[model samples]
Target: MTDWAHHRFTANDLLLDRQLVDSRGMMAGRIDDLELSDPEPDPAGGGSAARAPVLTALLCGPIAYGPRLGGRLGTWWAATGRRLRGDGDGYPCRIPLSLVARVDRMQVRLTSPRELLPSYRLRAWVADKVIAPLPGSGR
Candidate 1:
């Protein structure tokens, strides 16, 4: 059987909605978007693993993905994301290939969890200001 068949992922699976976590294993965010490069290369004499091909990057958050989703709506979405963030160019968090440990049915496990991640401002803001104030925030 093909390796992918053994792994069992269908192409049509919803990748965008998946949650991303930190190395210490806290919920970071969802997989807001993906980035890809041209398939041809190897001029630089870099090595590769025998069993797996290298991934260029894993992108998360609105700014990193906004441009890929083109047109005026994309622009609007990007701008709004920046405003909500309060400042900055709004680049999506880039997870390097080296940090990934494995991909199971529901989530991508990372070799380095939590130690390298920062607190997610938006999540905290929403939780503290909105959800936590509600009757069942902890539950």
Candidate 2:
């Protein structure tokens, strides 16, 4: 494994948009934001072990994603988002840190498929309402 210091990503580079994937290799969504935690020092010989930062969880979909992109648009987006679910849990999708299997290039591999999650409502809605209205919707 290459040392993180030698890796290509700068601090700003890490904050940009990226896609999130699942273990079955399905497209989960985009990496809207990162969840960070303080590092725990290893007690063994009082030395630091080599490891990438823990992933924690992945945030995705429009409602969850929009707020991360904060501003006027973000506020309107989040407000409209809440109305969609009608008091359903208005949470951005969260995938546990343990689910990640690998991180390569700009994509994350997970240990389970997206179907395992309950946040596919947006995907279904788009397909049913918007896309279904377009020409050759079934195709």
Candidate 3:
């Protein structure tokens, strides 16, 4: 697994709610949660049987955001997202760790281009259906 120990920052303090940006510098979304790989045996045979968890992916979308928000409003938000997706998968969009370039004070930059991300589904739909048909909207 890739070692991120060199980076000194807590996930909750530095990552959560931070904006995600693609390689082309387009705003993708905000990070709601971090997906960590299951703990594995320490190769170095440390005192503890399990090593520290490895960062695997970043979770985005309403499905992820809802639970963090909590209460009835959170449930409704997640339900609305599920309805819009129209798919059996209720999980949030997961961006792999490999695609992440760097995490700064403000945003997490991705190695992949924006067009390749599934996170743009809602934005694309809104642009095509709601914004494109407006009177003065540039088609």
Candidate 4:
């Protein structure tokens, strides 16, 4: 179990697309992007040197995923997400970095259960707008 807070890591090398597992070991989702704290003066007291942004959260789902695709398809997908969200921001579900307990070759483990994560909002929306409208689905 790597202590992510103290370790130096490249987000793209270790995090993107990694499987996410909740405390109970249930599959939560894949990491689509990472959120970093705005750069700040180094806590180590380096006079004017700015510290690299620290990882703050994990972003998941289609809205975050689109940027990683990078090109015409990515642009179209992200725009579609913003249109669907209708809120302009279109930020995907964000799981705080504090919840992350471990990271390995293929997975990023969370200390809390998936129920505590906001990743389900998209699923709920789809159920309401798409699934519930199906002929056999009982609303």
Compared with the true structure, what per-residue lDDT tens digits does model 2 show for residues 1-139?
2113224554345433656677677787766656654367466646445654554565665677677779999988877776776667777666666666666566766677777765567787788889998999885
lDDT of each: 0.59, 0.64, 0.83, 0.80
| Candidate 3 C-alpha error for residue 133, in Å | 2.4
Predicted candidate 2, C-alpha RMSD:
6.8
Clashing pairs in 1: 22-114, 23-112, 23-113, 23-114, 24-113, 24-114, 64-92
> Model 2 Cα displacement at 53 (Å)?
12
Q: Which order, best to worst by lDDT?
A: 3, 4, 2, 1
Using Cα atoms with residue i matched to residue i, what is each candidate's TM-score against the true structure? 0.54, 0.61, 0.82, 0.70
TM-score for candidate 1: 0.54
Candidate 4 lDDT by residue in tens digits, 33-62: 888774575588564534566678899977
Q: Which residue pairs collide, candidate 2?
A: 23-110
Alpha carbon deviation, residue 77, candidate 1 (Å): 1.2
- Any idea how many clashes model 3 has? 0
Best by lDDT: 3
- The TM-score of predicted model 3 comes to 0.82
Candidate 3 residue 31 Cα shift, in angstroms, is: 0.2
Between which residue pairs do clashes occur in model 4? none
